[model samples]
Target: EAGVAQSPRYKIIEKRQSVAFWCNPISGHATLYWYQQILGQGPKLLIQFQNNGVVDDSQLPKDRFSAERLKGVDSTLKIQPAKLEDSAVYLCASSPRDSANYGYTFGSGTRLTVV
Candidate 1:
């Protein structure tokens, strides 16, 4: 079973630039979720997709953040007009929980730093 995959491992951008991150969830997993974690706080769910259909995205910051899970597999999360407060770790995780339960298969995240 391969673990989740995230890209760049790190990123730095100006306060209003746009950036995107990619993810590949584990094999055979039907549920995928993207989360933003601040320096000290716990991981916060941004969006969740199940087989290309969204299950939950209430916490997603639509003003600047958007994501997609086309083909019901891989995914990408984007942030446009990034802000200084957007610096955080973007994590991608998957579980057998379908859409009701959640767990952490924590991967090396894309650490975005806004300047």
Candidate 2:
């Protein structure tokens, strides 16, 4: 089975600029997730989706970030007026269902550089 796919492997933007990242989950997967990883820290869960419905977004910075999983298959994450603190790797992952044992498959990630 194919893993998650993300585009533009890298992105460089000046502070306050907007940026978007795309992801396509594995076939038949019903759950999707987005995570932000700062250079020296572990990945933080930004948002999660179960068949296009939001499951969790407690850690997401709502004022500057947003995401959507349309039709339960593809998803996109966007940042408006991105801040220097937003420079990090945005990762996409998917799972057939919520199970810690099964785990999720992650994409290569979109590395954002906010200068």
Output the number of the TM-score-best candidate.
2
lDDT of 1 by residue, 36-83 (tens): 999999999999988789999999999999999989889999999899
Worst 10 residues of 1 by lDDT: 97-106
Error of 1 at 110 (Å): 0.9
* Residue-by-residue lDDT tens digits, candidate 2, 1-115: 7889998799999999999999999999999999999999999999999999999999999999999998999999999989999999999999988776789999999999999
TM-score of 1: 0.93
Give Cα distance to truth, residue 34, candidate 1, Å: 0.5
Please, what is the TM-score per model? 0.93, 0.97
| Candidate 1 RMSD computed on C-alpha atoms after optimal superposition onto the true structure | 1.4
Supply candidate 1's per-residue lDDT for 52: 87
Model 2 / residue 43 / CA error / Å: 0.5
